[model samples]
Target: MKNMVYGAILALQFLTRFPLPVNCSMDHNTLKWALRFYPFAGLAIGGTLYLIYNLLNGLLPLYMLTLILLTLWVFLSGGLHLDGVMDVADAVGSNGSTEKKIEILKDSRVGSFAVLSVIFLLLWKSVLLYAVLDSSENELFIIAIPMMARFQALLQLFVFHPFQNKGMAHYWKQHLSMRDVIIAACWVLPFAITQVTLIILFSLQICFSFIFGKWAVRQFQGVNGDTVGASIEGAELWNLAVLYSLFLFGIV
Candidate 1:
């Protein structure tokens, strides 16, 4: 019980900018068990977004609401996953050797590719959020997208080899276990039970994660923290797109 509490705190601290009630040690075992709480972190993020949406839904214009939501989203996560997206973009655009690409991923300096990718990603998410705002099923989406994205990250941790023997991804992989994945999957049950469509969408997201994982391995020889971040951001974007498409087609 104590470990679970510490693990949840560690997961929240790692995943979000939320203030912790108390400080926790960064022991390797605690960090490893924290992987199981990744979905809970996502749930926290989504719940906050949902609360903000309701608070501002009628007070602000759709575009403005979306802008604020996007800002809050970034603020909440400290742009962690988006940073991954940019790093991956820079690495991929470099067109260099695997070693060179890995070097780019490690570089702190942002490049043109990173800038462009971030812009497009924010724009895409903004548009999708705007569209979904008026849908009746928006709340479900709000609560599920982040959970699914984080779950995808967990899936990647289980399925892919870490590119390096150090860094956050390596540490997570070292501690990660099949039980962690199973527990994470259990977190999705409530959302899945509420709607069969969610189950199908989650299945698709899982499939995409595996496909993306294989591609990451082929390109980088294995996954890293950057790829995990990229996967989270990509998964969220994919989930939003799918939800919006279903909304448009009257399928949701």
Candidate 2:
């Protein structure tokens, strides 16, 4: 329960400038420990965003609200993971071997591919949110999406080996176990039962992680933090695309 609280606080930290009592002190299971309860962070982000969406629903135009929500989200995290999404996109598009690929990802200069990818993701997400808001006023679904996205991230922590480097992923890789996986599954499963649509979205996200992570491993020799971020970002957008497409075509 304490860990879950930390996780919620951590999520708030990611989404906003809330100060946390705990520091990233590199303690035992600090990274893995922090991430183990990370899904709760999603709950926080989703809840806060839902509130904002409701508060601004009639006060602002749909596009403006969409932009404000996304901009606030990015600002909250200082665009940390999104930057990873951009870097990974740039590296994947470039002609390079594994070593060269990592070098390209590490380069601070943004490429055209990176810019294009981020723009598409932001725009796509904005549109998706707007559509969903139009159809459903229940803000819980908004919260659920980020919660599920973080849950998808947990799978990579358990399933894939990160490329060699000392970072948060390394910490998670070392201390994470099946017991942890079971625990996380327990928390997320009940939520899954609440909506068939959620079940499909959750299942789709898991499928993407294996296929996407495997592709990253094959192409880059192993997964890295940037690749993981890209996977999360991609999975969220892909899930949104599928859901919205179904709505657009009246399929589901």
Candidate 3:
């Protein structure tokens, strides 16, 4: 029980900017269970966003509300995934060899690609959120988005080989057992089973992770922490886009 509580704290500490009462321990054994609590952290993030949406809904213009929500979303994660997206953009844009690309990812300097990527990603998410907010039925689905995103990240950790021998990705790959994966899924399964639509969406997220894992492996020879973060951000956007598409077609 204590380990589980510490693991939850560790996950929240690593994944979000949320304040918690418990001190996070970095001991490898304790940290290994952090992945098990990742979905719980996502649930917390999603619930917070849901509350914010309800509180602010009707009080502001849709565009403005989306802008504020986007800001808050970024603030919550401390732009950790955005940094990953930027690093990935720089790597892909370099058009270098695999070794060179890895080097580019490791470099701290931002490039033109990184700047452009951030602009495009923020713009894309803001626009998508605005569109989703325009539909009343879609509001409730927001809580699932972050949860699915984190699930995709966890799936990647299980399926892909790590790019580096050190760092967070490698550490998680080393410590995350199949049981940890099952525990993470257990956190998400109830919500996913609530609706057939959600089941389909959940399946799509798994498929996305599979495809993404393959592509990441091919591109970098293996996935890294940056790619994992990038995958989470990408999954959230993809989830919104797909849900919006379904809404447009009157399928959901």
Candidate 4:
């Protein structure tokens, strides 16, 4: 129980920019166990955005609030996943040898492909969120999307071997006995079962992760930290698109 609580705090610290009041140990053992709390960390981030939306919904124009929410989302995550999107975009756009692509992914310099991808992704996400906000007053979409997205991320972490540094993945596979991932899924499964839409989303997330995982393996022969980050951002976009489509058809 104590480790689970520390794991949750460690997850938030690693996953977001939120200021925490207490300090905790960050050893590899703690971090590997902390993987179970990633989805809840996402929920905390999304829940904060939901709270802000309620507080400012009427005071600010919908468009303004939409931008504010988007901005806050980026700030909260410290653009961690966005960095992944940029790196992977640059790598895939390079279309070079596997070694070359991996090298490019590790490069800190941004490329034209990185710039274009981030612009397109953020633009589409903003447009989608604006539509969802205007069409419905539901808080579940915002709160649930991030939670599911992080579960999607956990899928990457749990399922793939690291293409570069293999330490974390190696330790997790060795020590946790895979129950840690089950615990993470347990955090999400209850909420996913509450809605048929969520169940569909969960299934889709699994399918997408497998497909993406294969592609990553074929491309670099395995996954990297940036690639994991790419999966997280991509999952969020998928969630937003699915939700918006459901809303457009008056299904959710």
RMSD in order of candidates: 1.4, 2.5, 1.3, 2.0
The lDDT for every candidate, in the order shown, is 0.87, 0.72, 0.87, 0.82
Candidate 2 stretches with Cα past 4 Å from truth are: 1-17, 29-32
Let me know the TM-score candidate 2 reaches against the reference structure. Answer: 0.88
lDDT of 2 by residue, 103-185 (tens): 89878899999999999899888888778666653455677776677777778867988887676566567877877666666
The TM-score measured for candidate 3 stands at: 0.96
Error of 3 at 244 (Å): 0.7
Across residues 1-252, which tens digit of lDDT does each residue of candidate 3 receive?
Answer: 677779888899889999876776777667767888888878888888899988998899888889888898999989999999999999999999999999999999999999999999999999888887786464656778888899889989988989879988998888788888898998888888887677877889999999888988888999999999999999998887887787788887
Candidate 4 lDDT over 1-252, as tens digits, reads: 667678888889878888987687766567766788888888898999999999998999999999999999999999999999999999999989999998998899999999999999999999988987888655666877788888777777677777766544444434443677788888778778887777777788788888887888898888777787788888888877887787788776
Which candidate leads in TM-score? 3
Q: For model 1, how does the per-residue alpha-carbon lDDT over 90-206 read when each residue is reduced to its tens digit?
A: 999999999999999999999999999999999999889888776654477787888888988999988899988999888888888898899888887789667866877798889
For candidate 2, give the lDDT of residue 167: 65
Give residue 103's lDDT in candidate 4 (0 to 100).
90
Error of 1 at 71 (Å): 1.1
TM-score, candidate number 1: 0.95
Against the true structure, candidate 3 has what lDDT? 0.87
Error of 2 at 9 (Å): 4.6
Q: For candidate 2, give the lDDT of residue 91.
A: 89
